[model samples]
Target: MKKFYYTLLALFFMLPACTKTDIVPFTPETDNQLLEYKIVNVQGSPIYGAINQQDSSITVYLPFYLQLITLEPEMKVSDGATVTPVSGTMIEDLLDLFHKGREIKYNVKGKDGKVKTYTLHVQVQQPDLILQEVSTDADNPNTYSLNMNLDFDSFSFGLDGAGFAADLDMIRVMLVDEQNKEYGPLNISTFNTTDLTRLDFTVIRYKEQSDPILAMLPAEGLYRIRVYSYAKVATTKNPIRINLLNKK
Candidate 1:
């Protein structure tokens, strides 16, 4: 009985040491913080609603020649959290108007007292080229012909695009043969300057003996006319191509 009583006393003394210590639980954020960002107003035909959000950053591609660089954005953030540079806020113009993009920071404070900063990138994109019309000197309505043996004249076309022509650093015109040979930064003239939405340009073939435009191409083969757009800041997208054939 004495030994049993001593064993009970030892067990009681060890109970406190066996107790588990209290610890704080770990938490991972899974809330949908940003819902949407929409462009509200703009001038003359600038593209909008191009907001792409990844994680905590948002990107907006604006037209290159957009004169009024200001914009009002509508944003939707998580519930119980407030954001700065609030929705419908008219952001000021870009710092380096013609050469650089703008950045806006949005601060969000959640209900848990945590603050996060999201970056908004406003960038410009290179204009896209489109062939609105093409014409050749071929008399036959059914077939087109190119007589490189002649003075290399009588070809013209109209060009337009999804962006402004003023945004382009330069437009390169090339003729690609089936064998992948490219020829001519063909001289072209524009009809107007201010409104570049639609440009009517006429292709002028050089008559120089040493020029590639004077070289005699295949009499009967497939050829392509490519127009490339180079922007001042943005990456140039794919060039526009127009296919033609000479059935000589």
Candidate 2:
């Protein structure tokens, strides 16, 4: 009975040594990343930014009409991460600093106090008016033609009327032959502005126009249609090829 009592005392003393008093405290997460970014509340449309993880940079393509001063970007970051120049903050003053050809820096700090910086690049997407469709006029098959699907709203006109003035903008229709010879730079001066919502060209009088080449039916060949603007040059990515049947 005395030996069993001594064994119990030894076991009780050993329990204190096994108890862990120096427990490792929980460590805060160290994840700091700018996951998603986008510009919102613009005049036309919201522009989404592309995040490059390799270089830790974000790039956004802003339409020419939208100014940087009008941007209020929305951002998403890693959990428990805080961003400076917080989301939805107007960047008018920041724009002044940006015009100096400097990248805007966005800093994100994690719960662990580790910070990651990301640079933002803003690029202005140029205005392009594509030739959507072209067809022969039914009323005057040989004399009149119609141009369709020209987006006038895409072009931004400045306060001083620097861009896309109806008076200055014109459409050129050229006839190309197998020999690559060009004929008739038929210019359409009249534009259909009755619909102020979306301005467009209505009809092209091939025979009635003053251009002598357009006075008669264009020789059977490939006709290329292009819109011209003094403020900005127009480009046609896909040139249209149509066969105009001579009036019976």
lDDT of 1 by residue, 75-182 (tens): 877788777878788876453433334457888777887777788766566454455333233232123343444555444555554454563335455556656566
Instruction: Estimate every model's Cα lDDT from 0 to 1.
Output: 0.55, 0.53
Displacement of residue 47 (Cα, Å) in model 2 is: 1.4
TM-score of 2: 0.38
Best-fitting candidate, measured by lDDT?
1
Q: lDDT of candidate 2 vs native?
A: 0.53
TM-scores of all models? 0.37, 0.38
How would you encode candidate 2's per-residue C-alpha lDDT over 1-248 as one tens digit per residue? 99999999999999978957787999954478898898887656678899987788999876544434456899999998999979987655433443346557899998889889999887666354433333334232223332222221111110111234234323234444444445555444344433212323222323334234433434233433444332133433323333333322
